[model samples]
Target: MTTSAMETAVEVEQRYGFDLIDLETVRYGLIEIAREMNDTLTRGSFSPLARDIRDCTSAVHMRTENGWEMLASHEGCVQHAFTSPHIVNFTMSEWDESTLREGDVILVNDPWRGAIHFSDLNVLQPIFVDGRLEFVLHSTSHVADLGGPIPGGFANGAQTTFEEQLKIPPTLLYAGGVAVRPVFNHLLENNRTPNLLLGDVRALAGSLSVGASRLNSLFERYGLGHVRASGEYAMDLAEAAMRRGIATVPDGDYVITDSLDEDAIVAEEITLQMTLKVRGDSMEIDYSGSSRQPAGNVGTAWIESTRAIIGTKFILDPASPVNSGTLRPIEALLPPGSIVCVLPPSSCSSHTETGSRVVNMMTQALSEAMGARGIACDTGTSGVAVIGGVDERPGHEGSPWGSFAVPGGGWGGTWTSDGVSACIVSIAANCRSAVNEHVERESPLVIWEHELMPDSAGAGMHRGGAGAIFTIGAVSTTVITITGDRSRSGAPGSSGGGRGMPFYGWLLRGDGSGSTLDPRRAIGAEPLFGVFDENGEPDPDKGTFGLGTTYMGGKVSQLVLQPGDGIRLIVGGGGGWGDPLERDTERVLTDIDDGLVSESFAHAAYGVVLDASGAVDEDATAMRRRDLARLRDQNKWSVPTACPPAWNTATIMEVAS
Candidate 1:
């Protein structure tokens, strides 16, 4: 690919030969249509994942000579909406015009055919105008339970795709404006929560129906030729804008390697390597050096490449519209069977876990390439907790209930300001965090504790957001699955900034034994203050317990929690930007007043001295900062290394002792 392939704004205008005002009007109209589709889905949804958490995404794709390309999308679950074109193209290729028609809805979730994972059920409806198929409306939602060993499809212990759950190919979920009884019945029977599946599937179909009607209105208002030409012009404009963004970066080859703590089934770490090559106005991402498909379900298919595109958009040109043209100047080379591009039989139930890792890696590489315009790394995990069991609530006794909670982590700091606290991951655009009251109402559980962990953010001139502590207690026996990451290593900071704290999880016993179960311990569970002292520092006597070889809680499957038992999570904070010593003293005082930064952390990390009056001591603080800077300049102090957990069992025990 070359810059010549992209045209200038003037050239695009001349080629399309359409009124600029009309094009802009059509573009906004399409955006309105997409937003309407999104509103329809969420309003009509039944499951909390769709209704409350807003885990679903909707988009509009138009037919092109090469294939289908996205026109406009509801800005939620960015990966899902951006990747819809691939699945639409694939399905259209598999079944021609004979199989697809007006008033018909197609369903598919095969990762090989372009899907985020098995749990993301895709519903596509083909739009026909004047006897020609012109567009496809898409809606995707994470269905609750799809008949697997575990209730939710994020199976951390699965070794094969079959173990993940039922894989639905492109099938006619609704044909000719009517439901396919056999297909619908079979899908409902295969799921643990039939009511949820029934309602969610209908909701997706309903959203598509609304989109079709609105699209017809768009074409009717502006004749077919103008509408079609306007969409093409919109895409061309986006491509040119994207090319301009890429042209700003200094051309070079940037490389980065990172690892997940472990594939739940294997204690060994899973390494991911990437080499980004920039030439002129084009970029190429080569992931041929990543680890082979692991025994667990963390491996993903080709859809993982989209994360690289997403990274490009977020880092370089976030304001640019998301369309097929924005991806024209970028290319990704993913080796088959690698963690990023898994082959057949390899499970992908935990694709989101590894997918987020890819996004983080891309951020690190792109930020290094862009220099001052770069942003620090955010908490690299989505922090998804899936809990399922029978509902004992009044009027719903014996019915199965599932809770998909996304208590997202803190965001990394930018050049100008601190990161946002408890925000959703980068890939999940516009998705909301799970509400505690809603979760409790839907299930037999209590959210006992949910708050920001003070002094958790990385220290810098502009610090990262504070991480959070979440504790959920079960009212009865229930199955839990946690697919998260960033425990072995924290989110790496850029330049001289400090890395954030790692994630920690524990299962507290309700048997009055005061025993806590760490993921790394199979027996002899003991309660310990895993990562904090009286003043929020690492206890010299007690090393971090749920980390490295002693921690395997990042990914767990089918773990049972009894009545009165609770699950606690100390979510990791984001990486900081700039040097800690350079931070404003007044800002540090404000952080102290807000309880975001502790007095000890200010003294230790920032070299700031506070007097008994809770005010900065000018002379002592200046001296302390000078001494700390001298030590750092002489290489006597160094930032913590974000490395993999590769210790042996004996070494882990020695560290614990």
Candidate 2:
């Protein structure tokens, strides 16, 4: 390289506030590298979780003086885009990047360090150019198993680091393009499903290598000097845009707090609070009042726990790209020993449901800032059900056939449209439910029904999405574990909107006598507002479906079952945006026809009266709406009260024949 060229690169780096060249092409090329890496991982992985559900992400970064600057990331989870680069920076310091070599891959899953959880493994590869490592490629995937308390790593009872799952700290998984036998063997011996993990690791490694190859070509084309300059330019562009987005939120200190639905293990509901301070072009989120870290694995990783905080800026400016620049205008404050920032021995494995609550409450607090853009929260649980049993096939490998499903729930409502049903929540980005056909083909479990729960959405001007019900029939005796939430404090609505129905989980017992149970007994005829009991009063017990040998503990751990037995898991619904009475009468009639909203709900929540013919009663609906408007004028929405469990008036539950 020429001395003049080196001097030019240094000068460009020093004046790092804006682009010195045409950075648009540089940005496009970086994005292409990220997308290519994503394609490789999605195509190469074995598990339905990584390949089909897309619970993975990849990124390419430029090493900066202080940390790695995110050039681009795959169009996957937005949270990963913001947090993964910082993780890469953390890894650099932890392992001392100067010793990294070509073809060597670094693996990290220490939650206290930078990983979101133990299950989300990260594979890092150093990209060396001209005998110098200038950039790095990263790939993160939610591997199927890591030998936790359950088949899936949703170990609800994991109270300490030792119980959660295998935690692989920063280590050399590969050296000089060869697999480290001892490290690989250790992973295989510990994990129950080693084959799947091996495939996933291979996929991650391949993606990293591919990203390096692509980035190398970019270096050859643009030269290392221009390439580094371009990255700095792109970061500056994104930072400027992020600051502008922050400026729009109106300078003020907005504070809000919400409680997690209590489980048997944590008898008392834990509270998470966020105080967002928006001033000028930057924002600060103080989580000072959050509950202390729990004995269970419900704690969060401190390094990148601001998916909610950063997500809000994106929520306000949907067009902004997620890069190093986008993260510049915000600071997150999670004190040590708090729920959002845990220390050693504090479990972070069973963190998805808990993390979702953090994201939801943050979104709720910011709703006042961007009222229309502040959409309601989704069914915040991953709705995991891990099933395993002996595979007694003639040539079985002496191990049980096991497969798990992280079922997606409903997404919250927005000002312009109703919520999305049966999907992974907003924070998850592009992830969704793994195909059922693939699940049945891979294991002995057969899904009889996977459908939307009728009238399960929170009622509002733009009604929230309805939840889903999964009924799986096991062909043989098996052991199952469920790690989920939202049954306790079902998704809450806002601005006078009605809350969604709580979730339900049941086991058929398959007693052979063939008498079946009512599937929808928990929901009333008017299911929009709340769940009800058999007689007619509202029911508030989140564990009504915890009978018949099922587990309803903190994380809903293990239960042994028999052939012909069916497992029923009801995923919760999303929260609504505004008052249901403000909803259009025509839209309510349409919902009635579509079976999403019941006639009773139409009358009670939306103030839309339907005639005997199932058509809208225009005059009656008008009068009902007028009365609701009058109530609103009389300040009826401000009064709040305590409630208890009651019965459902609607007999929506179907008795099996």
Query: Which candidate comes out best when scored by lDDT?
Result: 1
TM-score of every candidate relative to the true structure: 0.92, 0.89
lDDT of each: 0.77, 0.71
Q: Residue 261's C-alpha lDDT in candidate 1?
A: 72
- Where is model 1 more than 4 Å wrong at Cα? 1-13, 393-395, 511-553, 639-657
- What digit string (tens of lDDT, one per residue) describes model 2 on residues 1-657? 001223354455456433445455777788889999999999999887679878788988888875787888885555566678767877877887667889999999877667788888899898888888888888998877788667767776767888777888799999978999998898888887788888989999999889988888988888887778777676766777767667778888888887665533665667788888899878888888988877677777764356775457546657756777777777888889977887888877776766677777766777777676667777777677877777644456366556777666777778778888887666676886778999887777778678877667778888788888777777667778777776665677766565665665665556532213334443322221123344433344332432222234325666776777777776777877787877888888888788676776667667788788878888988898888778779976421111222233233343211
Which 10-residue span in candidate 1 carries the lowest summed lDDT?
642-651
The all-Cα superposition gives candidate 2 an RMSD in Å to the true structure of 5.3
lDDT of 2 at 555: 59
By TM-score, how accurate is candidate 1? 0.92
The per-candidate count of clashes, in order, stands at 0, 12
lDDT, residue 287, model 1: 94
**C-alpha root-mean-square deviation, each candidate:** 4.6, 5.3
Per-residue lDDT tens digits for candidate 1, residues 1-657, read: 222344565664566666667777998788788889988988888888788878888888889886998888886678886687788888878877766778999999999998878888999999988989889888898888888888868987888988878898999999899999999989988888899889999999999999999999999999788778777776766777788888888899999999887788877779999998999888999997899988888888978777777778877777867877787888889999899998988888887778778888888888899886677778888878889998666687888888887777777777889888877677885787778898888789988677776666777778888777677788878898888887656677776777776776655667633233222221222222233222222321234534333345478677788888877776667888888888899899998899777787788777789999999997899999899899999998754322111211222233344
